[model samples]
Target: MKSSRSITTILLVTLFLAFFLGSASAQEPVELQWLLIKFWPEYDDPSLLVIIDGELATPGSELRIPLPADAELNAVATAESSGRLLVNDWREETTADGKRILVFSPQFPVFRVEYYTPLAINGDQRIVDFELPAGYLSTNEANIEALLPPSSKDIELDPPADEQGPTQDEVHLFQRTVGEVKDQAIRQKITYVNASGALTVPETASSSGALLQPTPPPAEETQDKTATGITGNPWILLLGVAALLLIVGGAVGLWLTRETDENEALPAASPAPKIKRKKRSASTTIRASQSNLDRYCRNCGREFGPDDRYCRYCGAKRQTVP
Candidate 1:
């Protein structure tokens, strides 16, 4: 009887341990491929954007993300295959240790979360203390980036960033990369001095209630257009118009010159023919006037024949005159 009781107790304990281990394994946190964290303070309050890319063992499984206690979630979404984010339904919960967490079931593997919290601002100086949530796990690569305010200067970072540079929009950026980030909370500190309270993000973007959406980088064609002043510069348009007018004027002038040259190379034209008039015969004119002549010569009173060479009376010779 004693042996049977001991064997039954052993069997019960083993079954209990097996069940507990199975449940724990099934509930293990999913490992992430990478986590990107961005700190932006261009609003009334500072904000953070977190993007997680990972594959779940089971699709449509529940995911729990830890955030700052004072964080107010702005947007929660999952990325589609087309790179479009579809907003997801999420709920906020608190753990026994007073840590705030967001719970959601993402339909896709990649997800995004955005939240805003207050910053530590003292006069002209601003400070940001950001850390990844302990609930998340990343493989080996993690990235943190902070966007400095417009017109800000005297930037400093704790455990200095790997890269610091200005973006095309003239916005300053500080970025850090860490390896083997798994389950550990990656923390960063950024400090900057800004006398002017100007905002880097456009007012329309913030007022439209979608400040958390990732702004796509400016297209290359758009930059080209801007550089050529095709969209905004009046001088460019004016110059283009002037150039076109010059080209048209030159073409017309060339055509006219070519026509003039062709005309000059042609042969001269011939003159018109002259009109003719009728002529009278001399014999007819003489016969018509013969009847009107005198019958005797004035010098010797001699008779003249029709074809007289000289008068014959002067020399005692016959003579005919007309």
Candidate 2:
């Protein structure tokens, strides 16, 4: 009887486990997807940037990508490969080559920004995430999910877009991939999550379309209380400004001190302008040329004219000029 009871308990536990997994299986099956998207610079050839969701995709570093037997990625050089990838403020340009390409090369045209480094494949899906710098932008997920195939449902979008793309808004990333199913390969739409937290369908895009405006940056991260503006470290800047003020103040103080020293070293104030006694002399007597001044009348050619009086003969007078 005890043995029978143990067997019954085992059966009951098995039943519960099976029920949980069965319900999950009845729901939608989650499949891994591979795709590429394109983005244009805001003004000139904008920097190429990529940001993936932690649960959806990984930043592909070409170091080595694991392509499943049933999956294949091609012509990543084009902009349509990513659903969340789109043009920044600048126009788009892709130069195709039989053997060489410009958009993905490390030099010149290709400037890539990768987020969520070193990715790993989890089951079928590989998840990765990253943030665009304060001034950069990435694709919108709402438009991308509209182009994806079945087997997955895109959430967090207001509504989905038509295959061509959302008419109201432009698609940022183009997603295109070839996946395998039941021994046959198929070309299909790629889906992924974007910054807006939506599963999006991306179309295999071509640099072929007319260029559009660049996407604006996301809301700034103000978690830091000390940042003054978007561009600088406030503490470093404050220090520099304070240093400059101190330098200017020090120079002024030193100049004032020197002026005070010179003033103190100067001769005593001239003795209240002394009055000197004059040596009386006859009108004809001549004194040293440099010491004493002589008065002369221009009209009469008379010397030592009446003190402060004009010569009667010449009508010319010598006043006390001093």
Candidate 3:
């Protein structure tokens, strides 16, 4: 029972250490802001940006935009642009040391949206559609048409002081900690410094290009999809057999591996015993004549033990010496 308890204790300590090893954060707070193109109406219109941290919006970080009269408000989250944004889901994250990360979509580069379902905008019937690859800024950076395909302008793009972007791995992980924040415009400052020097360029609404429109993709000169031999392609039976064989081989390999691991993990055999040899030992001592109380009787050579005052053999006497 003691040994079993000891094992359990060791396992618990190991599991505890492992748990803390992967915890997302152990230090102080971190704040992150993601630019959302919330209400872009023009091609090069300035984008709306939001900085989200937990559930609390940073002070003085609301978006400054003029909402049009009768414009239906709808927000569609997508993943497309840069091929890293989420088509639907957006998320936020942290590291073991607690560094915060916000992910955006890469597929839905530009997600066009209306706030209220079956919504309309600018007297135009806005289509509530979903595509892929847009980042946190899709709705906030409303006038993204300037960066759209027809324009793919040679506009000089200088990365943020710390240049980061959405990747295909995923985006929007921050939402995990951010919780639910919808349609509320949180205020924040967009600080931009001048390139040449001295002059600080204030962040004004981007008013540049035209609102991007959807262009039908070019017609594909497709190879003959007309099945030359098999209509539904029954020759694929051979491919199916090959795939089955591969699966079987993989299963066998996995089974063998499990068996090998089980064998290896079995408790090691008990240790062999150690043999030992022994040898006899001896000792000696001396006493004074006055202290010879334990001496034998000299007359008969019989032993005079401590209990006897005189020798039992031949009646030899014993005298006290002080």
Q: Highest lDDT among the candidates is held by which one? A: 1
Candidate 2 is scored at a TM of 0.26
Please state the error at residue 228 of candidate 3 in Å: 39
Error of 3 at 114 (Å): 16
CA error at residue 192 for candidate 2, angstroms? 9.1
lDDT of 1 by residue, 1-322 (tens): 4434544555555556555554554324556666677778754344433334444445677777777777666677787877777777665554435565566788787777777677778898888887665545545666777787668899898869899889887888888887676566778888888787776765545422543453333356654454344333434544555555555555655666677768777897777777676666898787665544445554686766666655657543332343
Please count the clashing residue pairs in each candidate, in the order shown: 3, 26, 77
**Residues forming the 10-long window of minimal summed lDDT in candidate 3:** 142-151
TM-scores for every candidate against the unseen true structure: 0.54, 0.26, 0.21
lDDT tens digits, residue span 1-322, model 2: 4434544555455555545544553312112233232222111111112322211222332211212222112222213334333332211121111111111211112222221123222343323222122111122221122222222223222222233333333434323222222222222222333333222333413222233223333235432221233222323444454555555555655666677778878998866867798956754354343224436655666765345576666676554442
Q: What are the RMSD figures for all models against the true structure?
A: 34.9, 27.5, 19.8
Candidate order by decreasing lDDT = 1, 2, 3
Which one is best on TM-score?
1
TM-score pick, better of 2 and 3: 2
TM-score of 1: 0.54
Error of 1 at 260 (Å): 99
Q: Rate the local accuracy (lDDT) of all candidates.
A: 0.63, 0.31, 0.31
Give me the runs in candidate 2 sitting further than 4 Å from their true place.
1-106, 117-150, 154-238, 261-268, 271-322
